[model samples]
Target: MATDLRVSLTDRCNLRCTYCMPEAGLQWLAKPDLLTDDEVVRLVRIAVTQLGVTEVRFTGGEPLLRPGLPGVLERCAALRPRPRISLTTNGIGLHRTAKTLRTAGLDRVNVSLDTLRPEVFRTLTRRDRHRDVLEGLAAAHAAGLTPVKVNTVLMPGLNADEAPELLAWALDLGYQLRFIEQMPLDAQHGWRREELVTAEDILRRLGERFTLTPEGSARRGSAPAERWLVDGGPGTVGVIASVTRPFCRACDRTRLTADGQVRNCLFAREETDLRTALRSGEPDEALADLWRAAMWGKKASPDLDAPAFVQPDRPMSAIGG
Candidate 1:
């Protein structure tokens, strides 16, 4: 059974990355439509205590935008067989909230930062908060969020040339670096296969500047990233080639959206509703059953290379990636 649960606290975000959403932003979920703090905690309790979830990752368009984040972490920490908690954020307000979150049981963080250039950041995100993200990363590291990961997506004509530069920066700062191949989860549905920068392209670019020996698949299990040792030593970098080197067969995650819908896969078009049952006063057992049913019905991973492939209607922001 899947033990890692990705829970979205909210659909709200401060930055408007070109790949994520329109500049005007998406239709925000209504207040009542979102699960209350108590409701969120209760569902987490059920997932951990009843359904075998061991790790909970808080994700969002940017999870830092959630006001009750620290409180949510505190409650989840109080659970028996306490889970390993982490957050995936844009690193905008993390500088202010890192210590509070660490105190509330968060173990680590993954910050999305595609480029090191301030101008490139503004161009990509349509926001001028690049320095804020850098500061937030520093603060997160100082606050003891070890293995602070940086997720970078290389857009063909944008930051693709900076792959080696990005890796060197991460290595210098003691941050774990991961380069992800841009998938078809963008809102505009403008992703063309021909424009994609494949995993080979990334590795070849980095190879010119550094020696990256494969860490091998013996320890890879359900994790998505394929690791490589930098200079054949302690420091390492990862590449998540979701399209070219899909690891969906080994995926061990179940996703819960901010609105309490259970998603079986990131690309799944269907979601099972737990919010309705949750608000209707259904027992914890009933909620767990619904979740179980959802996972049981998960479809096989999509073959992106096939002619039949169709992107999900929900973008990464809506799906909480």
Candidate 2:
């Protein structure tokens, strides 16, 4: 059973990253369709108490954008056999809420910082908030969110050349750096396989400036990122090569969208609705059984290289990853 659950707080985002969505932005989810704070906390309580979920990661178009985020974290923290809670955010307003979130029981964070150069950052995210991200990162660290992980996606013509520089910056600051291959999850559906910066390409480029020794599969386990010891020391870097190298067989994650739908896989087309049952006054056991059936029917790991493969209808933002 999947003990790690990724729950999307909202599909709304503050940034317009070129790789994520267009400058015009996506059609935001209606508030009425979204799970209320009480509903969210109740589902989480069931997942921890009735189900065997051990880790809970709050995601979003950007999780920090959710106004009731801190309260949700507080409730999850109060679970009997408390689940380890984390958030994945764009680091936009983190500087303002990092301390409050920490106090509300957030364990740590995985922030997106694709580039260090302000000009490049603006060009990529279509936002002039690079300094804000830096400040947010500092605030997160100051608030005791240790092992601050930085997620970077290298686009072909955009920030791909900055891989080594990005890793060096992370090493200097003791941040765990991860380079992700751009996937077919963009809202525009214009993602071309040939345009992606492959994992092998990232390794080759980084190899020019650093010596990276593979930490091996035994240590990697089910985590998407394949880690490497940077310069043969404690500081390390990781590559989430989801396209060329899929680790779905070892995947132990379950996803819940903001609207209370369960997605067995990140690329799955099918969604099982939990909100309706909850709204209809279904018992907690019924909801748990519905969740179990969804997982039990999870499709096989997607073979991106296959000709039959089709990109998921929903973008990454909507899917909670």
Candidate 3:
């Protein structure tokens, strides 16, 4: 299995970051409405065994919100061939959980950090504890999750000006940094086309300070970021241009929502209700075949790169970042 599986631990978050939770507060998915631990494990197994999945990423409103997240990661590690297990989070509660999570066999983590300015971070994430997130990054590093990746969403007039400094800081802190384009995933969250920081513009700006060596063309399979390393900077930097330079043609991954719906594409409006199918007694084989169907339906090119395609209704955060 070479595909990647994203398992949303919960639709709960501690920080209502502007780009993610726009309503000032989030409505949590009901306990019964969200997938159980067993359900997630079964779906992951099927994804690996049937879909030839090679990597599994745990995400969420904040993955650490899920009770016993480390245990879930351990179970995923126990899978045969041992798919590369990682997690993506906002780094709010990770300071205390990093050590245990790493010992449980979680291989990597991507912490979301947008601005270096404390006041700006507060405005961008709607929180004032920017220092806490920095401390969390320090703890994550201390926990020995080598090369922890940092995710930065660039929205012009917001955190866009902080890119160079953020990259420099991440390099100094020994973390991989990724700048993601602002997709029209949500409006109240401040996603607008004019406000977007395109990949070309970002690269040009960064190129002024550092030389980016081509990591060569991305090989098909499970990489979302088009990887790059600074010529002399500390760690690596990657760019995920879902809107500007969509790599949809090479997108081999699919998402399983917190509600147990499997979406063939992040830009998909409709999803197959796997929870209902599972409740109806669909065999594991059928469930696996359903995944195959989802992959087969993947667009040859991403909507951002295509002339026209179905625009998804849900926001990116709702799809597990």
Q: What residue pairs clash in candidate 1, if any at all?
A: none
Instruction: Assess every candidate by TM-score.
Output: 0.98, 0.99, 0.92
Per-residue lDDT tens digits for candidate 1, residues 257-304, read 999999999989999999999989899999999999999999988988
Name the regions of candidate 3 deviating beyond 4 angstroms: 187-190, 218-222, 232-234, 300-302, 305-310
lDDT values, one for every candidate? 0.92, 0.93, 0.78
How far in Å is the alpha carbon of 286 misplaced in model 3? 2.0
TM-score of 2: 0.99
Candidate 1 lDDT at 319 equals 80
Off by over 4 Å in 2: none
Query: Model 2 Cα displacement at 256 (Å)?
Result: 0.4
Model 1 weakest lDDT span, ten residues long: 18-27
Clashes of each: 0, 0, 3
